[model samples]
Target: MKIILNGKEKEVADSTTLQLLLQAMQLHPEMVACELNLNIIKRNKYGSTQLGEGDCVEILQMIGGG
Candidate 1:
């Protein structure tokens, strides 16, 4: 299946959940914010949110500085 991640198209396995996608990308959900198809997904729902073909995801990380 193909999904749009961070504005780029990528192929991912079927039945991929937000949690699994984060793991595959080596990202920690606790340290970042995620938006699926322009809608924000709460951290508590990552495990239950299923990603599918044509879906779009935007992930942003929180950084502290200055």
Candidate 2:
């Protein structure tokens, strides 16, 4: 399946959950925020949230420096 990840096109497995995708990308959920298809997905829901083809996903990493 193809989806737009952070404005770039990418292919992912069918029926991929947000949690799985994050793991595949080696991303730590605790340090990032995810928005799926224009909606912000709650961290607790990552395990259950399924990503579909053509979905637009935005992953923003949290950075703390002051």
- Please list the Cα RMSD from the true structure of every candidate, rounded to 1 decimal place: 1.4, 1.3
Model 1 steric clash total: 0
- Candidate 2 residues lying further than 4 Å off, grouped into runs, are 64-66
Q: What is candidate 2's lDDT per residue for 1-66, written digit by digit as tens? A: 999999999999999999999999999999899999999999999999999989999999857778
Clashes of each: 0, 0
Error of 2 at 5 (Å): 0.2
Q: What is the lDDT of residue 4 in candidate 2?
A: 97
| Candidate number with greatest TM-score | 2
Residue-level error in angstroms, candidate 1, position 46: 0.3
lDDT of 1 by residue, 1-66 (tens): 999999999999999999999999999888889999999999999999999889999999968878
Clashes of 2: 0
**What overall lDDT goes with each candidate model?**
0.94, 0.95
